[model samples]
Target: MILPFILVLALFDFDNVLLWTHEISLVSHKIWFCDAIDIFYYLNTRLFLLFFYFYCLLPPSTQPQRKNSNSKMATLAKLLSSICVCVIVMLTTKAVEATPTYTATHCTNTTTYAPNSTFQTNLDILLYYFSNNISQSNGYFLGITGFNSVNAVGGLFLCRGDVATTVCNQCLTTAIKEIRQHCPNQTEALIWYDECLVHYTNRYFAVDKIDPRVNLNDGNIVSSVDLGRFNQSLHGLLNDLATEASGSSESKKFAAGEVVVTESMTVYGLMQCTNDLTNSECGTCLKNAIGTIPNGKQGARALLPSCNVRYQLYPFFTSSSPSSSGGMKLGPGTIAVVVVVPIFFLIILFLGCYYFKRRSKKKILLPSIMENFGDEFPTLESLQFNLATLEAATNQFSLANKIGSGGFGEVYKGVLLDSRQIAVKKLSKTSGQGTIEFKNEIVLIAKLQHRNLVTLYGFCSEEQEKMLVYEYVLNKSLDYFLFDPHKERVLSWRERYNIIGGIARGIHYLHDQSRLKVIHRDLKPSNILLDKNMNPKISDFGMAKMIDIDEHQGNTKRIAGTYGYMSSEYAMHGHYSEKSDVFSFGVIIIEIISAKRNALSLHSLDFDDLLSYAWKNWRDEKSLEILDSNIEKSYSYIEVIRCIQIGLLCVQQNPDDRPTMERIVSYLSNVSVELPLPQEPGGFMGNRTNQIPRDNISDQRNNSNTTGSSVNDITMNNSFPR
Candidate 1:
């Protein structure tokens, strides 16, 4: 028994040393045990130890000495060893199978298919031509062979020296066959193999097409703490590889390099391009691919037009020769596993039992916390209000108290028992808004307090009733003066400009200055409420998102916003960013200066969008023509032109070109600063109007009323020029 235990311990000790070294290899290089086939090896060793233990347990003294008995035991041992060998073989096979394969196949020619007839015919002709070229050993180099035929359009080619010529031919043949089946009549297709690449396309995709690349790495990073440096090194190396690959000759468009991260860690990278591209084209394609990597991570793979590149801290490729540095040296911590495994197993079992014992007690304690939360937040406890008290407070939600009504709810002016005047927003149970939105509004708004943002007062909830209280804004919204004909006269260029500046400041606060960077996806004139002092306060955080400061953009399937103010990128692609809000601000600035809705304005002779119309007028030095007729006389032409230019700058088609809130604030405040020319605004009035329903306007109004209930009859009129 003692000998068996010692034998088992010795086997475990050997594996423990291997495990420790493997772990050190992983840690120092930021790889993993499973990543390097170490786990599989360790498991196989453990199984061998188990076999030895059973073998040693047999009673040798009582064993029969007959040849038949001895032969039987020998046969049994051989069978057991054979089983272990099989397991090891399967594990190794799996590791080999994990590597990606590429193949191409031939299609049978039929009278139905003709060259340049259909997209598929064109693609087939291209693939067949390339396959024949590779098979015939044509002297024509990759890019040099194809100026006249479809091959001139460009394709990918990968060659490995170790692979046999027959293997390469077979792989390409299989790839062509598979591509035809998978892509069917598609004009473009690509298939990968270990030895070769097969691709055919009708379109002129020879330009940098980096999309559709696969990224496969160990899902877990080796050291989360060193991620920043690792990512930086990875990006730097990738950029270099892209440059080298792109600059390679048409004969062999490939580049490989290794980056030393530390004394023990080295990251290897390989970049390869289709041998068809010119040096310049290859470089451009690879650069585009490199640009797509998400910042702040380890290990990435990208596909480029002429090349594909991958980088990892560990060596993924297998080599016939032993590495001079040794695969990866193991660390001491990994070696300790020999002694630590049994102890760890026992500790885990004990902890599991203790966890179950504690879990029972947690069940009893959870309800108490829930009850206390409900009692502390009275607003959440009730969903109904006394009809009589609401009626008495707002004179039965009388016409005098009525502020606004929309799809989901209504708003009315009310005075609470504490003598505080407030606006009451009552949401209908059957309204389009759901409970999640209602709760989201309450939670998000309660914690946000900005001078430019509306203040949420206490709320009242009773059976089937949801009401929100807000501080009353006596001056109404910017739309009151912005869209009215006669009322527009009250908004002098000064006040309109000030309002524009104030609104920008408010949005800037929500996006950057606040603790949470919020994107007000539904920013519009109506959402900009004004206090008695004519100071603008951005209302409605219900549709807002609290984003990480580092995040530049996000996507959502549900696109909610007023049509004209929404950016094209947001409307069409479901993508939104701070730049989306900037786009809206651009529209608002133009509306403030012109006192006209982008959707309703008919001043320009040729352009359909306010942004395009303004751009045309500015270029023609007739920008004053697009300004509000009422403000043109009172406002300085220079200031009006400047604001128009800034507005156009804010609504540029490219989000990257649009200034951040910080930049916008600086530009608006500094009159002498130079601004770049703006691109055509995307999602201009023409596209937006086509997609938004007429009822969406009414729905938005209702959403606001339901969200802001305390203000009574808030209307934009000539009487209120905030």
Candidate 2:
């Protein structure tokens, strides 16, 4: 591979690499012939190379070798030898070090346009615009040209999201000029390059398929001993990229990141979608693409028309670029898929072959890592209950049995034949989780066990009726007690204090103790259920993120969870971390000690939020004043003040300043531990709505305390939650 690449490098003079040759010279003539076959000669054209070698080997007959009068002929022969060397070196270089590897080309052979015809002329015009129009300073362009339906044509070019505008323009120009040469008179054509793709047809896309995927492994192998770890890290990285990238907009729907797979290796990955697909559409396409990435290899990638994804052991992306892409592919099924000829000095290396995946299905399901666990997951028989058993327990999912409802579906209180009470969570048919992803999450959640975390008893998957069975807690949820005036008394000072400790411990376990590091993205009062003793048990693993244990932060455009509880960094920007969870814990702690529902800590003249009011009093050296008046007799003033200080520490404006759960637990256990001074927190989030995403923003209603206010308060479950 190294030698061949070096040869190709020697063959091309970069000065003339882009310059086209019309008249024939040894170099020009050979290049012209090779290009007609393909700019890259369809990647190593065996037949053409064999013929060229034989033709060039045969000596020019009857040469005037010894005649002084024929000195010009000998000089010409010497020049010819130099040209052949250059071409051979160029061929090797073409394979080795070229940028923008070609994936595939799709042409609709269903129709053709005659040379010099009106349609052909329109296509030429469209192609001209795609290659020449680069002044906008972005890497995407779309246009259509033609007077009548018969001569009409449309075209669009997409450069890799992470590429420089200059690189983008160069790739587009080459793709535009070459697609025509490869497909010739085809009425509709598409060409793919690592840097860019040019697609043009008379009709615009309506229903896009996730099919004709391209899969490539860079021929590097992972050892058997390290294969399992490699696959696990790769899968987690790909899924994270998909979730992050899918939240992006159409102009540059892509993401790039790296994850450490082994002690010595870090895998880099990039995912991208075409500029036309919806956010959900992009997600589905990326999920499908991620599922197909090659396994047990040092490098791999999968490409689709709607989205593309790739990963390599050695870093392959520009860390500075917003997104980067690479992979190999060639597949069959489409009528006019063209493998371009090699001679076109502009030829790109074909990275891999393609396999057909039809887009006829109505619903797009998430792909494999979560879709199929295979042997790694425990069998469902031991964890599944029949529909009849659950139906009888919940009385046919009756409203009387229904305890709560969230974005996912309804949760019901049920009893098993053994008299064991259970929480039956019926998943909505339209929920984003498919059967495979649902089951996968269930398995992962079941493995996690802590007294403060809700327990998954089992599951019920009878056709479309998917459900999760959790151990039923008698006290309902934290919000029911914390928010309702009549019920608030039951949560005495001791119970509230214990609940705070338990919540912190549970989150700590999730972040550090569990085999898989899970980030409970939606952490709030409604999702925290209490057992008979009022012990807090966190619920809802549906929208939880199970990331690489080493990963510390994640970002997404589709923000889940209640707005008020979300950390400012997470709410305004899509960034979250274990510290984000600490921020929510801070809010809960303050709410408990103050007996003030989160929406309004206390109705003051200033209309300050819970955090702001608490911060003000604490800054004035009145920390004990923030405590709930109702707990006057039962609460320890010193302990309550300490809790307030911790709460303020957790909700600090800077996430880095917030204490970790481990430290919070330590603070709660040891009374003498000195705490840091608290700073004023961010104001009520009402005015900053513009920065947050409108989609997936959840909260049942605005706060009754702040009427006509723009605050996102009175939260409800808005995602897959129990």
Candidate 3:
């Protein structure tokens, strides 16, 4: 075609032939070619063909043989057609090579290496190891190579939660091959397939990374009669799955389940994390992933380095081996007669009846609960546990089950009949204030729901006994880790930073998102529970207060809270607010960073308290020094300094000087935000001469003489009585 077009242009004029030839060359080179080099190759080949036709078949200077010219033109057309067919075949093959089963890929553009370079060589070995060895396991593998940090390569691959060994192996093989092809010489790469994910990096990346995640929506809108109900059910199902998946063993961190969105509809969900991540890390990653789910979508998935979560109206995961019809494949007649048509409605009826029955019981308990307290009561009857059941679960309040005790009472580790674990807080009958606080905790936590907050399983109130059942956190409290010299090593700077963020999110939920505006009166390290994965959940709401959503502050005549964590106004004049929680959060932040208690003895003359020490360091521009030595060089320097400044801001003597939970969250999340200088914190007694005993100071604020400190208030010195 090009040869004929050039000949026609030449018949018009030699200049016209040259102009048309240049125009075709320019367009074809720019639009048809893949690269500059490819364009040059295409242009040179086309030009050569044109040169051969003009010079050999029919010269422009002398053209007389008509029959010969016609034959040559016919031959040129056949040759060009053959070339076009070959080019199309080659392009198709390249496209096929590029396509993979994976949904997304992350190849680092910032870092690339030469072919067969040291880093590339190490990466290739790691990839080969993963591809060959990952399939040998149930569904997980981690590999590392290189003798030094610079040349080191660490990578991991995880199959979807419910896939079998064979399917996992196949997916792993595909992922390994595809990632290497996609990333080529890049030092870092990640690829996610529906069945598995593969990741590799030069730096150590076994720890959880929340940001730089991939979010995908199926784009199919949920045609639900009640969108709100569907969303609620979806989130609830995902949350439950996250909890289950995060708590899974190190070898397998995966969970999948289905929840009824309505009487006739069900949403299937799945959550999984890299086996190497801690339960808390998995939980955090899943929670972050869940948060990114866009509204009005019927199905969505978010993939992070450590964890991923997915929810869909249709089943996307295989329950058994992939060979078994790939997924939950069902026939139309079977589906209509069985699960969806008949059983679904029956399940809804059963659940509705059960819900109403529980609600009725809660109503019965409400009057009794409010009779003496004379305050508004939340719906607590549903959370009620049988007194006998709890007694049995805790071995009739046996000494062997007791975990800790405080102003509220003793906490016992209890196992329910179904094998579920719980932390049972039995309020002391001797302490009248404990009863009030118990009532307070029941109302506050029942209405609040956040991943960072400890779950209130149920309560038991029968005769003289009142007990609160909470989801048992396996690793106990942050203080157990932060205060113990030997255990402190486990609390890495990354983990500590995560804990700080989790605590911040929990408090923010209490202040802003919860149905009630709550102030967690005792926000301290001991009050923060760490799950198996070292994720922090704020607990002990016994001292918490509930106020109107519009109300900014509250005044309490009976100030009952820990000394070091209490804000100045709340401690000195019984004034409390969300800002008060912020102050305690500040103190907790300093403790988390420094691994030092705020109530440290001043006898050493080094520092009066954690706050004073933090403030001094920040003022001196030596904020990094305030970080716990256990963290060493692993910490993000800017994040540590920002936290220090934020902590100081929260503990400022004047309540007005403090940032709200909303602002604090923004500050913590956005690194670009500039922070104002912090004023001196409360109880900044400067030196040993002015330092006061925290116990005396606390006693002065609340002289109720509660028999024992709260379970959280019990330091290592306070041993449990046998």
- Tell me the deviation in Å of residue 309 in model 2: 76
Which has the greatest TM-score? 3
**What TM-score does candidate 3 reach?**
0.46
Task: Assess candidate 1 and give its TM-score to the true structure.
Answer: 0.43
Which of the two candidates, 1 or 3, achieves a greater lDDT against the reference?
Answer: 3
The estimated TM-scores of all candidates read 0.43, 0.45, 0.46
lDDT tens string, model 1, 501-578? 888888888888877778987777777887876788787655676679888789887666665677778766678899
Q: For model 3, state the Cα shift of residue 304 in Å.
A: 52
Cα lDDT of model 3 by residue, 1-722, tens digit: 57655553443342322211111222123211133233333334434444455555444323444457666555544444444443344334333232325788887888788874556656755665575577466788876766454777788888887765666777788888888788788888889998889998887774446565788998778775768888888878888998999898657888898888777677889998888888988888888888888987878988887788888877666554222112234466644444343234335434545565566677886676676335534455677887866765566677767777665567887655444668888878876766776777777777778889988887877877888888888776787777765563467888888898899999999999888888888887777888877788888787788889899999887667765677667766688899889988998888888887775332346654678878887888888777777687687888888988999999998889999999999999999999999998875334455444454343322222322233336432221211
Candidate 2 has what TM-score?
A: 0.45
Expressed as tens digits, the lDDT of each residue in 1-722 for candidate 2 is: 35435434433435534322342333122211122223433333432443354344434542345455456444444434444455455556544333566777877778888976656655765665565566573887766766345667876788787776666777777787789787878877778887888888877553246454557778869999988988888889988988888897546888999998767778889988877778888887887776676678888767665678888776555556322222233344211223433433222211100011122121342233224445544565588788877875666676666775644566787655444668887777776533433664586777798898988888876655888888877776787677666563556888888998899899999888899888786677766888878889887765567778899888877565564577778867778788888888888898888767554221233346778778888988887777777777888777788899999998888888998888999999999899988776752252334234454453333323422212212223211122
Q: What lDDT does candidate 3 reach at residue 267?
A: 88
Off by over 4 Å in 3: 1-368, 372-378, 486-489, 600-607, 684-722
- Minimal lDDT window, size 10, model 1: 704-713
Best by lDDT: 3
What value does the lDDT take at residue 558 in candidate 1?
A: 69
